[model samples]
Target: MDFALSQEQQMMQRLMRDICSDYGLEYWREKDEAKEFPHEIWDDLTEAGFTGLTIPEKYGGEGLGMEEIVAVGLALGRHGGGVSGPNMLTLGPVFGGISLTEHGNEDQKERWLPEIVDGAIVSLGLTEPDAGLDTAGIKTTAEKDGDEYVLNGTKIWTTGAHVSDYIVTLARTSPMEEGSRHQGISLFVVPSDADGITTNKIDKLSMRCLGSCEVVFDDVRVSEANLLGDEDSGFYHVLGTLNTERIIWSAIPLSAGELALDLAVDYAKEREAFERPIGKNQGVQFPLAESKMELETAKLMIYKAASLYDSGEDCSMEANAAKFIAARAGSNACDRAIQVHGGMGFADEYHVERLYRDVRLARVAPVSDELVKSFVSTNVLDLPRSY
Candidate 1:
């Protein structure tokens, strides 16, 4: 099987790399420190058409697929934006936009898809304060009221909510039936400025520029026309998008690991220890070498998952495996880079500290590593369900 990127993929990578170069590590550092969104970078990417790689051509997007999106995500992450840069592309276009493209009706798609292609921020409101990863456990309710639905609930970790023009929220439309906790949930395209909807920004250790928030919907009104996909089938619709998310999440950490490895290697070459460069010492060399090997291995899984997704094959196993492997590899690589840098690594000047903070999220968010293990054990191994 051919593993090399095609000419078009290579061009996409180069374009993203060049755009990222204009912003650079210093730009990310400033944005992170200020707890501000990368508006300039966002505008640049949207203007250049990188934000809508997965969107269809009819929607004013590039009409690319998972493989192309993966290429852009890797280049953006590797160039020092950490998870923040790639997230901007994925959360809006790949995650929320893809959901709408697949499930949204003609009117919904006509109204929203073009906006997404033009760089509209679409936040996801799936994780509730109590639900966490158990999406079916969400307490948010959307009760039908004539031509509109009245929503009431709170969603935490709603990324980009403060700046989002629209939030693709999941709420319970009917009571859970026996033996099916996933049923009765539905998706809604709630306008961020809807009445009775309140958003409070959440402070966090990493990805500060992305602006995670707690969104409270107190009798918020949404028209029936805003419902996405079939009623009570939101769980299945979300599941479909999640497979794609896992692949992109895997790429985030994989690229971060690449950046960490690059920093460690460059430092090892220049920093002297015991009258010789650190590269001469096996103590330093081995960890970096191991990280490189792990990253390379994880990257193969990422490509496999993306390819399977693009080919319309069953990629749940590969997607989960890629995320599980890449998260650890990326986190380990960043940790090793910190050790290699000694005291300087702890300081933000070297930028390894930021990478450390950003890559660590891969192990937790979207899906935890432990959960991925459980999924693989049960789903792929034909073992009994654990949770």
Candidate 2:
């Protein structure tokens, strides 16, 4: 019931903000223009032990909870420069949540968990060219051949694929049943340099600076040791993992909206229009007011869901709602920011354009707003499934 950050959490947020401040908006804009990943900032994060905020301390991580993770992520988004700053820490937990903590064997955890905590990038490759959101429809297959499994398929939107050493991917090991598409899917830890494995970098509308790509698997082979969970049960495992991903993805918008609102507020106070400060105008004031209200609530929703998840509760509905609310608020904030800035918002030099585009992905990536409404309607309201 109490919704407040503890002193320690506040301190953590301050530390994150300080680190992020070192990399200013101009630093991010320069990287964005070149379409390059922030390696130096990433090194600082890794060195600061922020990358593994949720992993166990035994594995050289910070051994924290989802609240701490959210704090760090929010700080990165609001102050750590931009959305790309938080992207560095997203993949490892994304892979670890499903493959290591939930399903990996002791040996697997020892090997992968430490590396992930140490800031070794580990991406999740689930979305395929044909799968879209229908993950069970994946045609990527991994067949058992003695001690090895041969994989052949292409994965689209494989974020961090270009630089990551390993990615836990989903593929089919057994043939699907006559009518059941969800069955027969399995997960594997695939090396980026495995034979016949190649990546095609993608140019996207936004979040392009985050470094996602299309990874093609052409008869890439891996040892049986790479398998995650039981072979046929990978589909279920992926679903559970996705729930966590949805929660984190949802918070991204909250952070973005907060940052956008802050920038807009600053611009409104300083920018003069019609011989008066824009902040004095009702048009600018109302939208900023609305965005501020939305941002606070969105942040609370994100934190509530994150806290619920750390307690091992079913948070699917809350997570979806968080994503939905945060994305809308973030997008709205960016739009208001554009209106507030008048012309400067459109230019990359101002950086509101970047935040605007980045926030759009929260609505589309992982889940659409329409789909989230469908879920809430059916699950929470006892309505029939619309989709």
Candidate 3:
């Protein structure tokens, strides 16, 4: 398969890179330090038309596919966004735009799709205190009452909820069956300011600029029209978005690794040790070389998975594998970048530390590497399910 970028794709990359460069590493560093979202940069992205890359053209979007979004993710990561890069677009465009387009009824699409393209921030409410990786075990419930649904439960790690205009939430509509926990779940578009909804921010290890929080739903009500797809079929709908999310999340860290490696290489060539460039030493040279190879290899799988997803193929295995490999490779590259920078790596001014801290979240989030391995073990290797 031809892996080379077409002229259009190259232009997209250049556009994203230029926009991100305007913000630079220092802009990100200050945002992270203050634990503030990068609103200016996000506005820049929206104004530049990057935020609507995945939305359908009819809804004032660019009508792009997963491959194009993946390219945007890579460019954002490589420039200055690090972990927060993909979050800027993913919440609104992917969660709100793609979910509505793929599964929402005509009314739902007409109501939300254009809003997403118009720069409405949409946070996701899927992970719960008890249902981090075990989506089937979620305790959140949405009960039908007349013409509305009353949602009651808690969602943990609801990223960007404080600033988001709306939240795409998943909740159980019925009790779990003995043999099937995936049933009875449903998706809804919840207004963040719905009467009974409350959100409290959570301070985490990284991606401080993008807040993750605990969102409580105490009889939060929404009209029947808020449901995205057929009742009891939200899990299936979520499956479609999850794979796309995996592919883009893989690109974020994968390109963050590229940025880290580039910075380390530049540092190595200039930093002197023992009367010679430290990069001349085998210790530094070997790890950086290994990181380059790993990052390059992961990049290939990331785009391959994206391509498969855009073609409407079953890419669960490939997407999971890409996320697993890219997260590990990206984290390893940041670790090596830190090692190469030596003392400066721990310092924030050099930037590798920030990249390392931020990209490290990829190893555990958007789906953990362990869960990915289990997915591959059962589906790809024909092995028994371990978990």
Candidate 4:
């Protein structure tokens, strides 16, 4: 298959890189240090027409596909935004916009899609304190009361929820049936500012600018109109979006790894040791070379997954593999970059430490590496399913 980016895709990548370059590494470091949202950069992205990359043209979006989305995400990561920049896009335009575009009814689309394009941040609330990755095990309940649904549950790791305008939440609306754990789940677009909804920001080690949060819905009420897609079918709807998210998340590591490798290489070439540049030594050169190779290999998988998704093909295996490989490669690259820089790498000024913290999250959230391997074992290799 042809893996080369088309002219349009190349242009999109260049545009994203240019925009992201305007906000240098120092800006990212400051935001991370203060645990503040990159509101200025976010506004620039919205104004540059990136927040609407996946939404339909009828809703004031560019009507692009997953490939362009991945391109923009990678550019952000490579240009020093790391996971923070991509996370904002994913939480809002990519995840929220894609969910609404695919599942929302015409009225729902008209109501929410434009707002996202206009830079209304929307957070996803799926992982509860108990459920974790077992989405089927969530205890969040949305009980129907007359014409409204009252939601009660606590969602942990609700990224961007504190500042978001709305949250696309998944909750159990009915009793679980025998042997059907995935059923009874439903999705909703609950207003973040609604009464009874409270958000407490989580102090995180990485991706601090995104404001990962614990969002509590204590009898939070929403009209029937807020329901997204069919009740009891939310799990399937969420699965439909998972492949896209995996591909986007994979870009996090791909870009971060590339950036880290670049930094290490530049440092190696200039930093002198023993009366010569350290890069001349095989010890410094070997790890950077290995990281470059691994990062490039992972990048191909990311592009392949994105292509499959854009072409309307099933890509669960490819997407999962890409996420796993990319996360590992990116984290490893950052670790090695720190090693190459020695003591300076540990310092915040060099920025490798921040990238290291941010890249490490990819292996856990979005989906764990072990879970991805389990999926491959059961689904791809035709092995027995291991619970």
Predicted candidate 1 versus true structure: per-residue lDDT over 1-387, tens digit per residue: 999999999999999989988988899999999999898999888898877777888888887888888889999999977778888876578766788888999899889988888888888898987779989899999999999999999999988899888999999999998899999999999999999999999999999999999999999999999999999989998887888888999999889889888989999999997899988999999999999999999989999999998888999999999999999999999999999999999999899999999889999989998899999999999899999
In Å, residue 278's CA in model 1 sits off its true spot by 1.1
Candidate 3 C-alpha lDDT tens digits along 248-289: 889888988988999999999999988999999999999999
Kindly give the stretch of ten consecutive residues in candidate 4 with the minimal lDDT sum: 86-95
Off by over 4 Å in 2: none
Candidate 3 stretches greater than 4 Å from native = none
lDDT of 2 by residue, 270-353 (tens): 999789998998988999999989988888888888888889898889888988888888889888988899889898878999
Off by over 4 Å in 1: none
True-structure RMSD for candidate 1:
1.0
Q: How many residue pairs clash in model 3?
A: 0
What digit string (tens of lDDT, one per residue) describes model 4 on residues 270-299?
Answer: 999899999999999999999999998998
Q: Estimate each model's TM-score.
A: 0.98, 0.96, 0.98, 0.98
